[model samples]
Target: MGLRRLAATGVAVAMGGALVCGCGPLGADGASGSSASADAAARALIAEASLSFRYVGDSHVDETMNQQLEIKNATRGSVAPVLAFTALDKNHQEMPQVAVTTVYGSDRGGLVVPYGTSWDTLRFSGPGEHDVADVRVTVRSAAAARIPAGMHDVKTQALDSQGHEISRFERFSAVRLTNEDDFPVSVRIAYILWDQPPKGTTQQAVEVTSVGGLTEVPAHGTSVVQVSADAAAAVARNSNGPAVSIKAYNSQ
Candidate 1:
């Protein structure tokens, strides 16, 4: 998606009615000052908005390599910024970077919860190493490309060398997904392959990997795209099928 489309979806512009600041008009907050003050105040609130991430440890259980993160809106105003998480190597080198964002019906696009609200279950794939030391999370509000919507209707299949679904194959680590929208959507999916169960409720920490490639799904179109799955998780077998866990916005 382009920047304009993303912006158009995230922040809804009231195109039907032009809200012109008048020469003499009261404010919605009942203030008797300049009419533009309301709009200005709102803009100022988010002008300096920012995002912060809180690491909540990692989990490697239930065939899911869970890296829990808390997305915090530290600013006073509500904002919708795209969150990107980059895994780093021991030497602080950049590795797999996953971006958690989405574009929904008008009023939502990569829209994180409002101010003071935190969203969890933000995920991406890389080295699911519990012992890895470095990781970085960056937030950018201005961008052109956006992942359509949180992936939906994800399925899995075992394929042969010819890409034909078969009873089984050596590759038991794939997930398939299809876009369920009127426009194109981009998504990166993965399956947690090998993992080691940690003590107690802590999920098994494993080496993480995802289906490598960005998939584009056209409006109301269906195509099978394969992703990764853990072969040794005891739960996510090649034949176990594809599954997804996306934290998405649901309009009330």
Candidate 2:
């Protein structure tokens, strides 16, 4: 199946549910059925032609909420799905001042998720956001596209994937992207920082911060980018070369 541009139309919901109101005995059963149908629809959508969400972790930085989403593309072609985000409170209601934010994925510009692979990226909400207990992500629509010619034949790596203190109370991670393609490609990258887990626990704590934009990588050459998030500057610089994920789009 090919990807469909979702637009604002919704098909399947990944998280959270709504309260169905009715003054009858069937009301409760109807609400339960509705929730079940939503889950089934979401699974069906993924089985058709969409990516799946693996993990979602969030942390508060200053007044903003940062979420690290691990997304997996299990289709035959690279797909960029339009994602809709809603911050929910403990009651499963939308938080104040945090309206629904929709991120579009197009054949022309947005980052495309490589088929059969999983990667992490960051999303943000708020200037004065309330406590967001959970976030709802829905796949409104998606469109698939082929990987740019040169990019598909290129080998890429992250060099200098380490952080260093640039100033007191400030640090940054500098990464140089080396592209071995014969043509230039536009790239966008993200860095994931993790919080130290509790003593003697195997749980993994993660926080992701995005700090780079579309950069053009010269053919058979390299491009350097610096990333820093004050909320986790020290962790970003001290951690073992934070996991870096870069997506390349056509530079045409």
Candidate 3:
């Protein structure tokens, strides 16, 4: 059976209105200004409707293949909505990546969630029409034991109640290794970002708690990688913060 396309859903009921503001910071003492800034940075990144993903698939699993779908806004007046990919492993663990694209379809494009937006589906826009930009399927296993040589079924749908096909790209397999077994193996994540600061800004660094550990890839295995829509915002805020720096957990 074909996998069901899950619709993206929304979070807020009202737009542009500041509801109840939380009380003073919690804990033994109020949060420091820097800590508040850091929290704000994290919250900003998290609030964006962007998506994120490991370039080479889940680090916790021993899979050798994965897939990714991305969309960007190409016009003004329209905000780029966040794109999300929820991977349901056979084991039932839910893996989610949230961030924006490194590359926007146009200069005016940046992640946007007009009030009353839903996260149940992928939405795209342009001056007049909408479309999907890229669809990538990765083979991240040892080259020797590459995915079975045959046509693998592939399909992509907007995670909206009203299924939409923004755009479709060619499907092909490429080889790469995740090195999930702790052995040394070379892996690379190639992606574009929207409104990425000049390289110099990225040079400014910060420290962040390790959210998860890297998985060791076996000598002959592969893993897939993809970026989340909200990742761009998170990366931008974290790296561009005044004092502390934030790094994408797996942005190597």
- Candidate 3, which segments miss by more than 4 Å at Cα? 1-24, 42-119, 125-252
TM-score of 1: 0.37
Candidates in descending TM-score order: 2, 1, 3
TM-score of 3: 0.17
Clashes of each: 12, 1, 61
The estimated TM-scores of all candidates read: 0.37, 0.43, 0.17
Best by TM-score: 2
Report the lDDT tens digits of candidate 2 across residue range 28-75.
356546675565454435533456663233332222112335556676
Q: What C-alpha lDDT, on a 0 to 100 scale, does residue 13 get in candidate 1?
A: 11
- Local error of candidate 2 at residue 207 (angstroms): 15
Which of the predicted structures, 1 or 3, would earn the higher lDDT when compared with the native? Answer: 1
Give the per-residue lDDT digits (tens) of candidate 1, residues 1-252: 000000000111111112222233345666655555655444433422444555433432243324444445555444444444455444656555433322221122234233454433333344543333334654433111223232233333444446666532245333344456555555444333323243422232232344435555556664455433332343234333333222123111
When 2 and 3 are scored with lDDT, the better candidate is: 2
Ranking by lDDT: 2, 1, 3
